[model samples]
Target: MAKPTPLNLLADLAQNDTEAATRELGRLQGLRTQAEQQLAALNKYREEYRARMQAMAQDGMTATRWQDYAQFLTSLDGAIRQQGQALAQAEAALLTGRANWQSQKRRQNSFDTLVARAEAREQAAGARREQRANDEYAARLARAASHRQD
Candidate 1:
């Protein structure tokens, strides 16, 4: 990738600090995906349960079968709650990873700014040195001409 911005120079160093954080974020995202998949499966199970319950009711099932249906509904409710908790945890992990990445970026930016400033200062100093040498050379040239005249 072409680095169009001045900040691109800091990419490598910043990546080192953020590497673990980035992995963590990816992990979090994967967990979220898994949770969603499980949630989908649970939804399918709920539909199946409803269908079975309906079939039992139509077939004039005994009171015991109705009790079993109630128990199944309660279990499904608990599973849904658990899936919600998992989603919350995954979201929290993603947030943590984002915070870490931002911190790393800030540190890298500070270092890049310092380096640029130091390079600017060095260039200024070199220019001053060159100017002084040129002044001294001019004075020497003037003296040589004056001596020749004498």
Candidate 2:
């Protein structure tokens, strides 16, 4: 059984951090998508309402009916504006999340590189040790053969 390398342990922790960052980025992206969908729906409803108002105008609406339509359209416009703001905020959050994920990924890669280097060093050291052991064994066998000949 080989002892665990410190570099390997650090690499594991870095990988965990990367995974958490990825999850957070995914959540932010979901929120951004939902905000975009809501904004689209609001715009679509506003367009449909405008079309209805136009049709009513052709049919000769009374002054009161026109006033009511204007008021409702104003309210829709306000709602649409609010939704746009919300969408912007969500997009900003998504951008921040992406940046964080990238940073974590870079950290993980660095740790992985360190681990690879450590493993290579360990392997080289093991090889040297094995070679030395074989050389000593051969030397002992040569000495024993000389004594037997004597």
TM-score per candidate, chains pooled: 0.70, 0.93
Which run of 10 residues does model 1 get worst, by summed lDDT? 1-10
Off by over 4 Å in 2: none
- What count of clashes does model 2 give? 0
Overall lDDT per candidate, in order of appearance: 0.81, 0.93
* lDDT against true structure, model 2: 0.93
lDDT of 2 by residue, 1-150 (tens): 335777778888999999999999999999999999999999999999999999999999999999999999999999999999999999999999999999999999999888787778889999999999999999999999999999
Q: TM-score winner among the candidates?
A: 2
Against the correct fold, how does model 1 do in TM-score?
A: 0.70
Tens digit of lDDT per residue, candidate 1, span 1-150? 333344545655676777766777788789888988898888889989989899979989889989999898889979988997887887787788788877987887776676667677778988999999999999999999999999
